[model samples]
Target: MSDSIVSLHEPGRAVLPAYVRALEAGWSPNTMRDVAPEQLAAIAADPDAFLFGLNGRGGKIRLHDGSEVDRLPGIIRWIIAARGPESQFVGSINLRWQEDASGKPITELPPHVLGHVGYTILPDHAGRGYASAALAAVLGEARTIGLPFVRITCDADNAASRRIIEKNGGRFVESFVAPFYGPGERLMYRIDLQS
Candidate 1:
C-alpha cells in the first residue's frame, strides 16, 4: 500500500525533491504550461512562496491560457499527497472553499470555471490511487466547511478521471461545452457532501 497522506501546504517547510522530479520529468501543474527554470529553482528554495501563490495569498493567478485573475476572498487550500511526512510529493489537490460576498458557503459554483476541487498526479505516480485519495480527503474538508456539494469537471475523453470521480461517489450531472477553457464538451459530476 502507498504511504501517501494529504495535507495542506505549510510554510517554511523543506522542498520535496519529488517536485523537482516532476519538473524534470516534464510534469507541470494542471495549467499544462512550462515553468521557467529560474522559477523552479525559486520554488525549490522556498516552497512556501509557491504554496502562497497557489492559495491566492500572494495575489493574482496566472492561468494556462495566459489570463490572470485577481485572487478572490475565499479559502484556496493547496493539498499535497506525499509518500510520508518527509517524502516526495505524489500529487496535489486544490480545494476551494466556496463562499459569497457575505462569506456564506455557496452551494452553486460560477458557471465559468470547472469545479471546486481539481487534482493531478505526477506521471511517475499514476495508477497509484493518489487522485482518489486526495479527492476523498478534500471532500472531508468540504463537509467540514458546510458545503452541500462539490462540482467536478473533466474532459469527456479522460476515462481515468471519470473513473476516479465515479469511485468517489460522483454523480453525473450533464455534459456542457466549456467555452472558457476550450471548445470541447466537459462532463460535470457532483458529489453531495451531506451524503
Candidate 2:
C-alpha cells in the first residue's frame, strides 16, 4: 500500500483540485455539520476560504453529533495528506497544541476538544492505511513543536481508528464521557513522543 505525504495546508500553492474532488464526491470534514447548499457552493467557489476556515482559532466548533459549541483554547495546525508533493489530497489531520503554565507542550486536552490529533480521509481513500501514515507524519510535527506526548481519541466502536493509533505507538489510556459531547463514550490513547 502507498503512504501519503502530510504537510501543512498551503493556500494558493497547495492542491485545489483535491478539494474540488472531495466536494464533488460529497466528502465533508470530520467535524463539519451538514453542508448546506449555499455552503457547498461557497466551498466550490472558494476552497481556500473553506480550507482555512478549518483553522482552530475560531470561537466555535462542530461536534461529532453535528452540533456547534464554543471552541477551547489551543493552537490548531491543519494538515493535508497527499499522494505526493502537490498531488491529490488523500486526507486531513489536525493537531492541537496545548501548553502548561511554563509554556511546555502538554498531553492533556480540554473539555471541548477531545484529543490532540484528529483526522479524516475521503471515503474512496479509506482502508489504504492513509490514516496511520498521516498520523505518523503528524507525530513528527508534534515532536518539532516539543510536545512530550499527545492524546488521541476516537469513537469507541471505530476499530480502524483504534488500529491506526496503535500503529503509531499509541497506548490506551482510558475511556471517558465527554461533558460537551453527550452520551457517547470516547476511547483515549496516549502516544509518547519522548521515546
Candidate 3:
C-alpha cells in the first residue's frame, strides 16, 4: 500500500471513514485521551475546525485534562493516508517544538513535552512501515520549515519505535524519565537535518 501524509488544513473534503472507524473502535488521534462523545460530536459537526484547532496555528492548546497551554513555537499535524482506489486514514503524526515570540523554531522541547515529533499508528496498521514512512515524510516538512533538527522520544523498551527512528537517521542522545510523563525511562534521539 502506497502511503502519503496529508496536512489536515488542505482544502476539499477527503473521506475519513477510516478515521470514524478507528474512533468507533476506541482509537484517539491524541494518545493522551480516548474518543470522548463530546469530541466526537465536535469533530462530526465541523472536522476542519477541529483539525485546524489541532494544528495549533496561533491558538491555545487544550490538553486532555481540560487545561489550556499557550501555543508552542511551531506545530503541525497530518493524517497518514493509504492511497488507492479507496483512500484510508491509517494514523496521525505531528511535529511541535519550542519557539520564541519571533516565531523561530528552537530545537529544545518544553518541559511538559517529551519530544519534537509524536505519532501514533492505528493498532491494525502497525507492522506495515507506515510509521517510518510518515516520520520520514514529516522530517522533510520540518526541513523545509528551516528546522535544523528534530528530537524524537520513545519508551526505552519500545524497540520497534527505536528501529524506525534509527532507520531515519536518528542518533541516540540520552534516556531519562520525564517528570511530566510519570515514571519509566524515555529514550531521546536527535535527527540532524543539516547533513
lDDT values for all models = 0.69, 0.70, 0.73
- Cα lDDT tens digits, model 3, 14-37, are 544556667778777776666446
Query: Candidate 2 has which clashing residue pairs, if any?
Result: none
Across 37-76, the per-residue lDDT of candidate 2 in tens digits comes to 5446867777667656654354676565667776544433
State the lDDT of candidate 1 residue by residue for 1-195, as single tens digits: 222455555322454455566667777655445664644787777777765665554266566677887644344333455654455566566666446778787876655457888777777778877788777877877888788988998989999999999999999999988766878978999999896
Residue 11 of model 2 has an lDDT of 32
| Residue 178 Cα positional deviation in candidate 2, in Å, after optimal superposition | 2.2
What is the lDDT, from 0 to 100, of the residue 128 in candidate 2?
Answer: 74
Stretches of candidate 3 exceeding 4 Å from the true structure: 1-12, 35-38, 73-75, 81-85
Q: What is the Å distance of residue 144 in model 3 from its true position?
A: 0.6
The positional error of residue 53 in candidate 1, measured at the CA in angstroms, is 2.5
Model 1 Cα RMSD, Å? 3.6
Q: What's the residue-level lDDT of 132 in candidate 1?
A: 83
Best by TM-score: 3
Q: Cα RMSD (Å) per model?
A: 3.6, 4.1, 3.1
